[model samples]
Target: MTVLDQRALNRATLARQMLLDRADLPVADAVAHLCGLQAQEPQEPYVGLWSRLRAFDPAVLSDLLVRRRLVRTHLMRRTVHLLAADDVLAWRTRHDAMLRQRVLGVYRGEFDGVDLDELAAAAREVLADGEPRTNAEIVSVLAARWPDPDRRALGEIVLALVPTVQAPPRGLWRTTAGVRTVALARWLGSDADPAGPDGDDPPGRALVRRYLAAFGPAASADLRAWCGLAGLPAAVAAVRDELVAFRDARGRTLLDLPGAPRPDPDTPAPIRFLPAFDNAVLGYHDRSRIIDDAHRNLSVAGARFVLVDGRVAATWTVDEGVVVVTPLRAFTRAERTAAAEEGAALASFLSEGENHRVRVAAG
Candidate 1:
């Protein structure tokens, strides 16, 4: 088998993630193409889309949320994600068990004697009226029936049980609002039930394919890390015939769709800004393809980073409408100029043209 070195994998990742070159796709299609943007931070998706899409207007994303074309929900690792409405409805049911298990893993002792199925039914009854409710509001009502678990635990467990979409104004671009959730069915106007697993693997075989399209040439372990699903080995095995495999420098097997883009290792990757929790860095078990192992913790720390030469090179933030960048390492003069130019554009986007001045801390 061929061995893909780190630089080769880095270029491939850049190509697949739409960071090598900005794409002209619409906001909704880009969201679907990327599977979804990790959106616990409500304003993060706007930046995620901004970095990938050409001429991205924040209002377009907010309009999609208002039109029900996009939704924010708990899926894939049970974290808040901004996903396409159709994709969420189709994949939500497949993720039900994993979501439940994850929440239980956190509060198993509190739910010792509570019947989860009964609790789910009761929780559904509470949300059946179509009115969006905040977590605290829902938890207060659930407290009346299942007082064993504290309101906090009960609320989390209820969310795990009930498939829901965080209502709008929560994920609207540049809008700050508290999280309010309602049934996924109510938001999409259709229940989440995809067709049965086509092959011997399981219902998630389709997910395996989708993951490859957006983030692929990955190992089975990487797939597991990306989706937080433990049972995809069967899915991978079932789909192995259709995929081409390569060995990375680490000797771990990497699988990819036969026709997916695997750009030249020396491809010139422009500086790009990424939002916190962006999947391009977190989508694999081994992130050495895009980020250094020493800086791996930064991805989980919710640090917004600047990518220079397609690798994470600096941490950045906004202060008084100006973009502030602190480099993780020294940069060449040309690279510094490129980073500042891109940072200025991002600042203008974020501040609505009030600020485009970027202060790059001297190394």
Candidate 2:
């Protein structure tokens, strides 16, 4: 088997993630292609999309949320993601067990002896009227039934048991609003597609295919880490024969769609600014392809990063119209120039062409 060195994998990741070159794809298609944006931070997706898509309009994403074309919901890894409405509906049922298990993992003692199926039914009843409710509001309705239960625990359980959308204007661009959830069905105006009775041909199988398409040449562990689902060994085995495999330098097997882009290792990579929790860094079990392990925690901790030569080289923040970059390693004069150029572009995008100032902090 061929061995893919870190640089080879890095360039491939950059290409697959659309960071090698900005893509001109539509926002909806880009969201679908990237699986979804990590959107717990509502305004971050616009920056994420701006880095990936050419001529991205923040309003297009905001409009999609308003028009019900895209939705914010707990799905993959039970975290808030902004997903295409159709993708969420089709994929939500597949993720039900994982969502429930994850919430339980965090609050198992609080929910002991509480019949979850009954809890689900009751929560659905509260949401059935089509009025969006805050998590606290929904939990208060069920407080009567579980008076002794922790209210926060009950609220989280209600979210896990019920497939819900964090409805707008929470996810609207530049809008700050508290989360108000409505049933996914009500929000989409259609019911979530029920899983097959036997749970055969499980949704994880499709998830595997999708993951490979977007973030592939990845290992099973990478898939598991990305989705937070534990039962995909069967899904991986079921599809193993269909994928092309390579061994990474670390000796883990990597799987990829046969025709997916695997760019040249020396392909010149431009500096790009990434939003907090952007999956390009978080989607892998082994993130050495795009980020150094020492800096890996920054990805999940919601620190926005700058990519230089297809790897994380600095952390960035904006203050007073200037984008500030603090480098993790010393940069060549050329890399600093490139970082400044991209940072200026990002500043312009963030301020709608008003501010393009950028400062590269001394290493």
Per-prediction TM-score, please? 0.97, 0.97
lDDT of 1 by residue, 222-242 (tens): 999998988777778888899
lDDT of 2: 0.90
lDDT of 2 by residue, 1-363 (tens): 999999999888889899999999999999999999999999999998999999999999999999999999998888999998988988888788889888888876888888889999999999998889998889888998888778988888788888999989998977899999899888888988777643365566778899998898899999989988887787788788989999999899999989999998989998989999999998998999899988888988989999999999999999998999999999999999989999999999989999899999997
* Cα TM-score of candidate 1: 0.97
The per-candidate count of clashes, in order, stands at 0, 0
Candidate 1: minimum summed lDDT over ten consecutive residues — where?
A: 194-203
Candidate 1: the clashing residue pairs are none
Once fitted onto the true fold, the runs of candidate 1 whose alpha carbons sit more than 4 angstroms away are 194-203
Candidate 2 error regions (>4 Å): 197-199
